[model samples]
Target: MAVVFVITLAMLTAATVISGSPVTLTLERAFPTNHGVELNQLRARDLLRHRRILQSSNGVVDFDVHGTFDPFQVGLYFTKVQLGTPPVEFYVQIDTGSDVLWVSCSSCTGCPQTSGLQIELNFFDSGRSSTSSLISCSDRRCNSGIQSSDATCSSQNNQCSYTFQYGDGSGTSGYYVSDTMHLDTIFEGSVATNSSAPVVFGCSNQQSGDLTKSDRAVDGIFGFGQQEMSVISQLSSQGIAPRVFSHCLRGDSTGGGVLVLGEIVEPNIVYTPLVPSQPHYNLNLQSISVNGQALQIDASVFATSNNNRGTIVDSGTTLAYLAEEAYDPFVNAITATIPQSVRTVVSRGNQCFLITSRLG
Candidate 1:
């Protein structure tokens, strides 16, 4: 169960606000290479001209999402796609670090019986709707093997499946399948009566993980990674060039960020100064310094490699878990700052100290 607590939304909002920017993030198609793939950097000012803000409650925190609707959008829960077929109305986390868009299948085991945010089975079963199908092994979307692990594959029919492991000791395993998706258009405070966009997506059929069991209501997840099969890529192939997404987290649980697509409202947003690095197209963090001290950590700790070059910056993950070397200095700095009276003994018989603070 990869379902995140609504309370976690607060942390997400905080992270988004901290990583502020109005720069245009670029995406490009690439060919596999031993070193790393390359991406096309399109100017942000040229692609985005407008942005819209939406508010939705995830049974806990109410956050904002900034995105557009000229093209369709996909939402996810527990690594499953929440809205796929017609009458698709559900909240989704617009993630840039992921590539798969999936929703819990109709026959999912241990799924909650409640119906509101879950996928509409009637719409999926309707003759008007396209049937969900599995991805073939030959498809480029299928993983050749698990990224950054000893996992290797020899099967030609390795169905579309994902094994998502999270920092919170939670994860999910499921096969990916495709289905038709729909989205309604709203313009200038009114729903466009004649506007509806159709989309294709990969819905997860099976799900099992810690978060899934905890947040039984979560149905699936939507991946927005820099890959050809992602929902963004799908839209781009259809001539929805230069799609953009921006999130502005709320100040509190009641207020969240917006997930915008196609364009952004530059005038209303604040832009962060950009630091150019090797154009992995992934957000690069040269280092993390708290207060004023630079913590010694592995540079790779700040990034995850995709196509040897792209690094995914995930706001959903909590705790700045730096590479092992960096963690030591960070821990030492914190320990040195705290008074001994508030420190707790490390449980592993290590010299590490855990301190509790009482802020007044």
Candidate 2:
């Protein structure tokens, strides 16, 4: 659903505090690395892909997951996930904006078999896995508030199934199943522990919109949300991982970064509090400044209310959506900070411009 990105999730636990434990994952950018394609051309496609991802706020991470940034193709980053007994590997998009991890299942209706990305896509065959079990409505995990909101019980078999509708006519529906997920846990500073945990995830039967298309399709999505059903929470509940996870993009062109299951403490690191009673990782934006000079915009402009939405840290989206009212001042401050002679246009391929829109 379009509001899936805006839906409220569970409260955070103190377990997120920096400690010795974390789960690490390797990631790959969902960009097509075609040497024949023009860089700008790929950049243009990046905007289109980004728009499709958002136009559909929209809808849509992580053990110590790290990813590469594709300069030519800027899109969602994906990671290889191992599920089932024999452990079928699947490439799933990493999303912090939405809850629930799902993959295209065998006998799927509209799941994409192949993807435009360099990697091959794999379907989750629950029927083949000896350890796989359907999650019934009466199951304790199925009765969670978040699961109950989207999941329904089938009278015939008491199966717990769900249908998530998105505003852009894009959505996914499937049944709940419990399976083994293999992970690499990070201990001490860098020690790695190979591990496995039982997690409840979705076995997608159908998909619509951009999801059904192969251009950017993958096995499914891996959600790092703070819900009982999310892999992150389930692992935390099992004492296999911490509830709090942190993500960061590398400063290099590769756009690579870290997605750790536990907090990472650094010297002189700035700390910010999560807004209480708000969905997602909501943050109180006290101010905005360019080169030490504050933008002449009202602090209230960033405030979240019952009607007006505020700021939340969402990793699912590649671009930051700024409010129209706050755009000019923010841009003006940046423009003033930069020398007039500085090149604003980079061969039309790397042109930089602010994106303005309303988010509610």
RMSD of each: 16.7, 15.9
- TM-score of candidate 2 on Cα atoms, chains taken together: 0.71
Per-model lDDT: 0.44, 0.70
- Model 2 score (lDDT): 0.70
For every model shown, the clashing-pair count is 33, 6
Best by lDDT: 2
TM-score versus the correct structure, for each prediction: 0.55, 0.71
Identify the candidate with maximal TM-score: 2
Q: Across residues 7-90, which tens digit of lDDT does each residue of candidate 2 receive? A: 222332333324767545444434434434455665655544532311101011234333445525646677778898988888
- Indicate the worst ten consecutive residues by lDDT in candidate 1: 54-63
